[model samples]
Target: MDGLGNYLAPDHRRCDDYFSAAEAAALQGEWEAAEAQFNHFLAGMQHHFAKEETVLFPAFEQSTHLTGGPTEVMRMEHAQMRGLFQDMQQALASRDANAYAGAAETLLILMQQHNLKEEQMLYRMCDQMLVRESAELIARMNAIAQ
Candidate 1:
């Protein structure tokens, strides 16, 4: 890949694809399909977050010494997204499509906003500031388990 954005930006789209598939299945009342897709989506997202929190963000922080800047905001947003995941899980477990839809809508909005910021700002920052370490950082990110 080109670098940080090249590796991680596609992941954002992959996760979005999973998220959309799961939501579509859920909205259609296809509980089994929804469960399968949601599980996949959840696992992917958790892995993505771990890669960022453990590998990418730490590298950025060390390189830039800006620990409490964008990374901190991203961590908070990750927490918020995790909470939404919980709500979605509970709604799925209960077979409450309406509840799931509500949560999914909120999640979709949040995710779009969050992904935009990361793609436009954070990943660009990483690409610029960590150019020398890009390959190592990408390898570490790729090594993270889903």
Candidate 2:
């Protein structure tokens, strides 16, 4: 059976792929293609965030009996990313490559740091502390509506 990290880490990569594709399209000034790819990336990110926020984080908090630790930090970071998402969306709507690049660069940095924390620390801790509940928690995450 896969642990939390094993199950969730692949999603980060999947989302990254869409993000890269969107960036490539935008760089080429292919607004149609960029819009489609950006939408895919946005949906992927929103879905991933939903899985963590709704399922994994809640379970981790319940198990650890602490609400003001890693999960809180992750939530705050998620909000920051959401704001950047809006900026990117607006840039896309305007076909403003400069704005898009600026927002994407910021988002990319935040995502890298955020993913590192989740992959290196939070997921590992979840795998250990919630080992017995890993399957159930993953199942719940999977069931979340995109």
Residue 69 miss distance in model 1 (angstroms) = 0.7
Report lDDT (CA) for all predictions: 0.92, 0.93
Clashing pairs in 1: none
Cα lDDT of model 2 by residue, 46-145, tens digit: 9999999999999999999989999999999999999999999999999999999999999999999999999999999999999898888889988988
Q: What lDDT does model 2 reach?
A: 0.93
- For residues 39-110, what per-residue lDDT tens digits would candidate 1 score against the true structure? 989998999999999999999899989888999999999999999999999999999999999999999999
